[model samples]
Target: MHGYVHKRLASTAAKLAVAPSAAKAFPPPDAIHNPRTFEPDTYAALQPPPASSLSALAHRLGLGLILSPTEVQQACTHSSFVSFYQKHYPKEPKPASNANLASLGNSLLGLFASEYVGASYPYMPTNIMKAVVSGYVGSKTCAAIASEIGAAPLLRWHRTPPTPLSPAPLLLHDALSSISRSIIALVYQHRSLPVTRQFVHDLFLSREVDTRAMFKFRDPKKALKLLVDKFNRERPISRLLSETGRFSNSPVFVVGIYTGADQLGEGFGTSLKMAEFRAAEDALLRVFLTRTPPEQLSLPSSTFSPTQSELYKPRKRPEPEYIPGEIGMEEMLYASSGKSGYLNPTPSLRD
Candidate 1:
C-alpha cells in the first residue's frame, strides 16, 4: 500500500511539472475557498461603482462637495443590498451598510432639532415643544423631504437569488428617513457641527409650522378653564367686540376674551359661538406660540470647539434665565383664588 501511494504521488508531480497550466488552473483544495486567492480584476468587476459616480445624487441633495464619496454611497446603500452581496460572495468581506449611520444621524437630528426649537421658542410649553420637534423630523415628514429632493430613485437595493418568490425591494418611508438621517451623519462626520446645523435648518427647520392647525384640544373650554384656574385669574368673560350685518345672510361677529380690564385675545367668526371659540383659540396661541428670532437663539453646539483649551476659559456671561411659564405671567397677571392677586391689586372672583 505504501509503495502504491508513493508511486501515485510521483505520477501527480510528473503530470504537474509537464503541464504548468494545470498547476495554475487547479489550486490546492484549501486555497480554492480563500477570498485572497481571488483575482483583483474579478473583484473589481463585481464591485459596485465608486463614490465619484454618485456626483449627480450629491448635487441633487445640495451637498456641493464631499470629501468621502464612499461614505455617501454607503449612506445611500440599504441593508438589503449588503445582504445580496454577502449571499453571492460569502468569502469576501461584507460591504458597509447604513444602519449604524442611520442611528447616529437620528441622534444628531434630535440634538439639532431640540436646540433650534428651544432657542427659537424658549417659552413654548413642554407638550407643544415636543409636538413641534416631532412635526419637523418625524418619519413621514423626513420621507416627504427625501422624496422632494429626488432621493428615492438614487436609493440602492438588490434582491438576491432572483426568484419568483422573492419580494421586490421598495423604498419604504422608514428606509427613506434612515437614508436622510445617514446623509446628515455623513455631513457631520466629514464637515463641522455648524455646517450640519445649517444643513438641517435649510432642509428641515426652514419650513414654517402651522401652530394653530397643530393645536388639538380635547375640550377647549375645559382647557381654558384649567389654564385660567392655574393662573388664578377670573373666569374668562366673552364680550362682543364688534358685529356687522348681524341679521344678514353673511354676518360677521368679533368677540374678545376679558379677565377684568385685561383683553386676552380677540377673534372674528360667522357666529357668536364660533367667535368665542376662536377667541379661546387665539388666547391659547398667545400663551403657546411666543417666538424669538432664530438669529438671537443660542445653541449648545455653540460652545463646542475642536481645539479650545479647558484652562483658557472666558468669564461666563450672565444669560437671562427663562422660567418655563414666564411668558404667561408677562402677558397675563396671575391671581391666587385664595388671596389677592400678587402682581395686580384686583381680587380674583373665587376669592
Candidate 2:
C-alpha cells in the first residue's frame, strides 16, 4: 500500500512540473540497488523481502519481481495458535502442533495446484512446474479449488511433525506447488522478462544499480556523456567498467564511440572516448545563422566581469566640434524643415 501510494504521489508530483531542485527536496528511494558504500549485509538472510509483503498485493500486479522473505512474512504469518496459550506466552505450557500442520497444509496446496495445472497443459515441460504453481497461487485459483476439495485430509501425517518446517518438505502438496511455480518461471522466461541493457543505465544514473565498470551501458557513449555532462571531467568510463570482466573476460563492457546517426557505427579500442570520435567522424551536423549587419562596434574584452551594474552604463557620444573654416549647413536644413531663424537648438535650448 505504501509503495503504491508513493508511486501515485510521485506521478502526480511530476505532473505538477516543479523544478528538479524542488523534487529533490523530497526524494524517494529507487527500486534498484543503491550504489553507495554502506554497511555489510550482516542480517541479509533474516531480512524479509518486499514481494512477499502484504502491502505489495495492493500495488504489485504479480507479474513484477518476486518478493523478499520479509515481504512474504509481512503478507502472511501462518502461526496455528492465533488465540491460543501462545498469545499470552504462558497459556500453553507446551509447544503447539498447529503451526507445523498449517505450514504443511500450505505446502500441500502448492503441490496440488501444480499438478492440476500441469495436467491441463501437456506441452509444458517438467521444468515449468514451479512457474505454474506460482501462477496458480498468485491467481488464487488453487486456493479456491483446495477449499472445495476439502484439502485438510491431504495435510494429515501418520505421525505429528516435530517442528514447523519438518513435515513441510515431505508433503505431496509441497511437491505440487514446486512444479506449478516452475511452470510460471518458465512462462516469464519465454516472454523475455530478463534484465535489460538500458535498465542498467537507469540503475547507474540513480545510483541504485551499481556496476563494477564506470561505463557499463551496452552503448558506452551514453555512459560517457552522462559522466562528461555531470562529472564535467574526462575519466575512463568504458575501461573503468570493463575492469569487472578482466578476470572472467565476459563481454561486460564495450569501448568506442558512435559514428552513424542512430545506429552503432563502429567500435574501436575499449576507450569510450575513441568510439565517440569515430561516431563524430561519420556525420557532423550543425546550424548557423547571421544576425542583421550592424556597425562594427569596439566592445569590452570578452573575459571582463562587471563588479556592479553602474560599470555597464552606456557611454554618451561626444558633442560635434566645428573648425574655424568649417561651413555650417544647419541654416539650410533649418529652412528645409521651415523652422524660424534657429536651424537647431541653441546651447541654452540644448540644456
Candidate 3:
C-alpha cells in the first residue's frame, strides 16, 4: 500500500510539471459563466455604452457634439453599479463611476441655475430665489427633466443581478439627478461654456417657476405695509373694487391694493378680510416676483463664447459678442405708463 501511494504521488507531480505540448485551436471556456462570453451583444448595461448609443443620447439631449464612449458611460454609470461589478470581478480593474463627476456637475448646475434665476428675476427675494434655484437642479426636478429628455432610460444602472422577483435596482431621484448633472459636466468638458450655458437654459432654466405660489405670508397686509414703508412709499390701503351677492351667504369681493394714486395689485375672495389679505399678498408678489422679459434677459455668463470648435480647432472668425445686462430694482419699480403695476417695468439704461 505504501509503494502504491508513492507511485501515485510521483505520477501527479510529473503531470503537473509537464507543459502543454501545443496550444488549442480555440480558447478554453471560463471556469465560471461570464456574461461577456455568453452574451457579447447584450452586455452593454454592464459595460461602457457603445459610441452609437451615446450618439443617440447626445442627439436626444440636443447636444451638437457627440461625447466619447468613456465620458457618456461615466456620466450614466451610478456608483452602485460600479460596486456590484467590483464585487463580481475582483481581479479586473474597477469600472469608472460618476461619483466625482456627479459632484462636479452638481456645482456646475447650481452655478448656472443661480445665475439664470438671479438674472431673470432681479427683484426675487433671496429665500424665494434659493427655492427657485433648487427647483432647477434639485433631485426631483432633475429626475423629471431626465425623464422628459429620455435620459432616464439611457442610464446604465443595475445593482442586483437580473431575476424575476428583483431584476434590477430602481433608478431613484438621486441617481437620476446625478446622471443629469454628470452629463452637463461632460458637456462643459467636451463642448464649451457657451454651449453648456445654452444647454442648461434650454433644459433646466426654461422650466417656469411659479414664484407667486412659493410665497408664504403670515400677515400679508402688514407685510405689504412694511414693504411700502421700506421703499419710501405711502401706506398701502385695500379698497373694495367690486362685490357680488353682498346679502347672500356666499359673496365675492374684489379688493385692490393702493398706495397714493397707483393701484399695485388686485385680488378676489369670499370675505372682505380675505379679499384685503389676498390683495396685500398680490401686491407683495408683484413687488418680489418681478422678472425681466425673456428677450431682455441677460446673464453675466453670456459674455463667454467658444473660441474653438468641438474638435478644439480655432474658429475662422471671432464669435459674436453678447452684451451683458441685468434688471435693477429701479427698473422693476416704475412702469412705462408711470403705473405702479409690476408686470412690465420700463427699461432704463445705466452707464
Candidate 4:
C-alpha cells in the first residue's frame, strides 16, 4: 500500500511538470507580481469618471475654463473613494482626496464674500455680512447649488452611513458642498484669480440675498436712535401718521419715523406700537442696507497683476479705474446675542 501511494504521487508530479499551461499558471519565483496583469473588472465603480461626462458637467456648470484630467479627477474625488482605491490597489500610488482643495476653496469663498459684502453694503453690520456670506456658500446652500448644477452624479465616493433624518442615504450635505469647494479650489489653482473670482461670483455670489430681511432688530427704536447718532443727526421720533378702523378689532395704524424734519421711513401695522416698531426697522434697513451701484463697485482683487501670478496670463489692456470704498460706521442694533439677536459690527468698521 505504501509503495503504491509513493508511485501515484510521483506520477502526478511528472504529469504536472509536463503540462503546457502549468508555466503560465505558476510563474518564475523571482518574477515581480503585477496586479495589473488581470483587469479589475469587479470594481467598475472605482474607475475614474469618463472625460465626456466631466466635460458635460463642466459645460453645465459654465466653468468656461478647461481643467486638466488630474485636476478634474481630484476635484470630484472624495476621501472615502481615495481610501477605497488605496485599499484595493495597494501597490498603486494613492489618489489624493479633495479635502485639501475643499479647505482652500472654503477660504477663497470667505475672502470673496467678505470683500464683496463689505463693498456692496458698506454699512452692513459685520455679523449680518457673515450671515449673508454663509447664505451664499454655506453647507446647506452649497448642497442645493451643487444639486441644481447636476454635480452629485459626477462625484466619486463610498456611500457613508446616513443619519435618521438625512434625505440622502449615500451622501452627506457636507460632502456634497465639498464638491463645489474643491472645484473652486481647482479653478483657483490652475487658473487666474480673475477667472476664479468670476467663477465664484457667477456660481455662488450671483444668488440674490435679501439684505433687508436679514436685519432683525431686537429693539428697533433704540437701534434707530443709535443709527441717527452715528450720522450726527437728531434722534429718531416715531409719529402716528394716519389711522383707520380704530374701533374695529383689526385697527390699521400708519406710523412715520423721523429725524429732524426728514422722514426716515414709514410702516403700517395693526397697532400704533407695532407700526412704530416696523417704522424703526424700516429706517434701520434704509441706512444699513444701502448698496453701492454695480457700475461703481470694484473688488480689490480686480487690480491684481497677472504678471505676478504663476498661472495667469499677462494683461494686454489697461486696468479699470479703482474706486475706494467709504468707511462704515458701527450701529450694533441687530438681534444676534440670544436666540434671535445678531452680534455687534466688527470693531474695524465701527465707531
Please provide TM-scores, in order, for all candidate models, with all chains considered together.
0.66, 0.18, 0.71, 0.74
Query: How are the candidates ranked when ordered by TM-score, highest leading?
Result: 4, 3, 1, 2
Q: Model 1 segments beyond 4 Å from truth? A: 1-53, 59-65, 85-93, 158-171, 229-233, 245-250, 306-351
Cα lDDT listed for each candidate: 0.65, 0.31, 0.68, 0.72
Best by TM-score: 4
How would you encode candidate 1's per-residue C-alpha lDDT over 165-192 as one tens digit per residue?
7564344776677678888888888787
Badly placed stretches (over 4 Å) of model 2 are 1-77, 80-97, 138-351
Q: Name every residue pair that clashes in candidate 3.
A: none
- The alpha-carbon lDDT assigned to residue 120 of candidate 1 equals 71
Model 2 scores a C-alpha lDDT of 0.31
lDDT of 4 by residue, 1-351 (tens): 344433443344333222212222222221223333422222334555556656667777665466765666677778777767877779988887898998999999888888898899988888788888898888888788777877666566777676678666655677778888988888887777877888889888988877667767677786676567667788778889999999999899999998899999999999999999889888878878889999888889878655443348666766766778887885364442235454454454345
lDDT of 2 by residue, 70-166 (tens): 3223223222323232433455343322344334434544444443433333323233334445444532443333323332211211222457667
Q: Which is better, 1 or 4, measured by TM-score?
A: 4
After TM-score superposition, the amount by which residue 210's alpha carbon in candidate 4 deviates from its true location, in angstroms, is: 1.8
Q: How well does model 3 score by local distance difference test? A: 0.68
